[model samples]
Target: MSDRGRVPGQDYGVKMIPYEDLLKHEPLREFPEIDERTPATLLFTSGTTGPPKGGYHTHRGLVLHTLSTALAVKNPPVNASQDDVAMVLVPMYHVHAWGWPWSTMLNGHRKIVYPGRFDWGHILRVIHEEGVTFSAGVPTILYNLLMHPDSPKYDLSRLKFIVGGAALPEGLLKATQARGMTVISGYGLTETAPVLTIAYLRPEHRDLPAERRNEIYLRTGINIPLVQLRVVDEQDRDVPRDGKTIGEIVVRSPWLFREYIGDPEKTRNAWRNGWFHTGDAAVWYPDGYVKIADRLKDVIKSGGEWIPSLRLEDLISTHPGVNLVAVVGVPHEKWGERPVAIIVPKPGYEGRLTENDIKNHLMQFVEKGEIPKWWIPDKVIFVKELPLTSTGKIDKKVLRDQYKDALPK
Candidate 1:
């Protein structure tokens, strides 16, 4: 294996030890006694919005998270077992790959496959060769896998995917379904030891039709075991479970970081009223499920009304011509900010996907009362490709910066 991302190129003050040389020494005869609250590791945030912040996890927290995550995948629709193999695609440096390195051991998975780098074709080959049955990654990674040229040649029928880092789009979900792969949505953040929710079906709803089932799978999901999640307004009051009232998602979990390392003010602001604020806007439903709208900073303020970028992007992604899409708000004199869609067209669609075509596509949804007519993007710009963050999510911060002044007064 190539030691690209693994090797620290610079001389950092600490000495490095080779695995082979370290094993030559005898094992420790005794272990040191330490409190469970002792810090185990410190991981920095993905920093898609701004500068990365450090969050430390306690030994106790990681243990609980491992158990909780193991339980989550074993419950209901997932029912992960020892027969299953895991190819964890999430970066290990980010939230410890959603705590799977520990959880997989707890779950006693049949095997674990690690792809040193995210070469899509190589991943497909690994999946086929290793008989990989389960995987977890951001939507972008899943997108690349499905769009790969050799995707059809591989048998992904038995594969199950857990998608996080961003909301899963309907089009992508359906495409995966068509390929006989099971995909579920998940939601979390860096500070919470990251596994907040997984969209697994309840026992009662397991017999529902495919369309109904897919709707549930597309949601942000309900709280995982031991995770107390709530959607609250600015006053910190719980929002109604009407599935329309948007509120910030606040969470209380055993594994959450106590503070943002070295940033006291941010730490205080994040953990207010005894909950860690996720800064993600979402809606609560009577079914006890939460559906994310957009990040608080990414929500577009148009004519004093909130236009959720995620919902718009989800709808637009279903268009046949669009391979990848990002909806961002640009400054507008009359409306404060208007949505503009940046798209990457699929092969054979370049230069053919026009603004009018997108507006017309959205109109169908508007007519069905699925989305408000006024929510349509004012402009659509096709791009060769969309920018991605280190964690493989759409880099909305970069998009916003690049198009901050895209609109004319």
Candidate 2:
């Protein structure tokens, strides 16, 4: 190992550790009786809408999560096994990079690429050079990759992506699908050993029409193995599986983090009612799939019905002139609250994007029964850019604060 001088953001210098030195350490010849409940690792939650929290997990939980996840990929679009190559892009500091480090090892080395510090150009090069077949990251990572001008230089048709960190919008999903790439959504948190669900289609839907099956890929998905998930209301009762009843998502998983470190009050609240409250508001589907519409605090309560802010954002994202978009609930006298859209138009469309364009685009979905008329935003506001959190998700808290009064009394 050689020292690499001083390292940024650290008090000490960086050193490269060699594999020969690592293997020189004493090895355990025989296994000893060990309790799987021992504390394994600590991870910090992304905290997109609030302050980040520390979460801890156990040995048993990690193994189970790794095993279950490996088994899950054995079927369907991501038929991962010993032959598949993996290039995990999720930040290592974030939920064990969605637990790929250990999970990938269990399936043996199928070629792994670690492009340190996320160079977009380098990432594209690695994918092509290493013959990378699979990868996972937040939606932003994928967006940047596809949006990169040099993206066309690389043949990415062989790659499959597992999106998480935030909801995957229909516009983004379809864009990747058009490229003949395998794109799917997964849902989890730092508190749940990180992955509780992935949007893999069921046996019945596998033979369905292509368009119909593709729609399933846009959902937050059904719970993974051993995960007991529920979309429930204030009374802690499961909401009707009508695919429109919005409710909080809570889960019971063996691999869930132990608790929030140094925060008892928050921990208690998180574990209330015998489940780990995910704070995600989603609709329950009859097919056992869960489509997350919005976070509870981010849901727009206009009139007596609930408006999913993410849904509006997704619709706006499809506009040709749009670069990015965010929807928030604004105060109103009659309805108590109303939806307001803040959009970032493409460079040429700046200040040219009109409120009517968005409303008219959304009406097409409404006319098709994709959404209700009341779900439409009351107003549209153009913006230079949408605020983003440290993790690159749209910072809705900032948006709410800035536009809370967008709708007048």
Candidate 3:
């Protein structure tokens, strides 16, 4: 019990204090008045490519994020109000829990919650028993809830969830909706106070049928207020709003992080051309919706053509027998690189799914001209589980390392 909090081989140079002892010092109920521009807190990125980078936010930034994000969700469609209760699932260590703990609480809401440790069965119970109307998490958490052994026992019909940290797989969204939860996708990174867009349907599309509406929902979505978001090419010119061309997503907003701590060279590179580079690749649509295709590093370049790995994953996920899927570019003799899939089958479909099954399914889209035939993966390899980043995204980086030379040399 002695010095349990101390980590070996390091001196933090601060005395450790107990929570109970600190409480006895008479807590200050009122926050000290401080300049709006004063730095408040710092957060780190997911570090998918390298060591995590830090982002610092000011008091002013936090307030703006709170006001804007609260208003966005409180409006029609979401309509979160005093009646709403949040069992927020995103971790506090993760960029203000995507800004909910402060936003929702400060927005005059009556209550808030944390499900604690993210056990789906327990989370479902908390939602059912506590009447949690709103929540936010990455797509993997939602999938776990839908596939939980006791999932059918709980009533999740009243819940409306905000999904981010990764693209929502089409099949997962459909499955969640079928069980009566209203699921919406969101987009952001550690750099932008964690939320830059929410897929709120525009008024015209709001009247569309479910099939059509879901297509809109699946897109990365329209930007929230005060966020200047753009899809730009290497020249920093806007791509056409034709919904097919791919470009990097760049943004300028009031609440963005100040910089990556202690890395001036990388920081300067990220802020080139007057906007903070997002490193996410996406397509712009006519109705102001933007569909994220893949991380720039994750996009597949094969035979001089770009293939969006996310789009391929979405299409493959719709197969009933597929539980999870990842597509990565593997070095190939003929094409420089070719797409190969690694799939995790549903509970009973193990050893039953084949490369041909996926190819034939993709062929339907090819026949319809929805996708080029050459875009089909060269092979589909089945596995029991797929690797994930700390942020819960399917870790394509890991997959590429394992299968980079999959094709015969």
- Count of steric clashes across candidates, in order: 0, 0, 0
TM-score (C-alpha, index-matched) for candidate 1: 0.92
The list of candidate 1 runs beyond 4 A from truth reads 1-31
Candidate 2 stretches with Cα past 4 Å from truth are 1-34
Clashing pairs in 2: none
Residue 285 C-alpha lDDT in model 1: 93
Q: Write the residue-wise lDDT of candidate 2 on 204-253 in tens digits.
A: 88898878877788889889899999999988899999998888999998
Q: Where is model 1 poorest over a 10-residue stretch in terms of lDDT?
A: 1-10
lDDT of 3 by residue, 1-409 (tens): 0123322122223233444566668877896676787666656788776678875677788889888788778644567888888878888877778999888887766668787777888888888888888888898889888888998999888888989988888988888888888888889888888789988766787689898889887889888888988899999999999999999999998988666766778788889888999989999998878999998888888988899888889999988898889899999888888999999988789988888999999999899999999999988899988888877777777899999877887
Arranged by lDDT, best first: 1, 3, 2
RMSD of 2: 6.4
| Top lDDT model | 1
Model 2 is weakest, by summed lDDT over 10 consecutive residues, at 2-11
TM per candidate: 0.92, 0.87, 0.91
lDDT of 2 at 182: 92
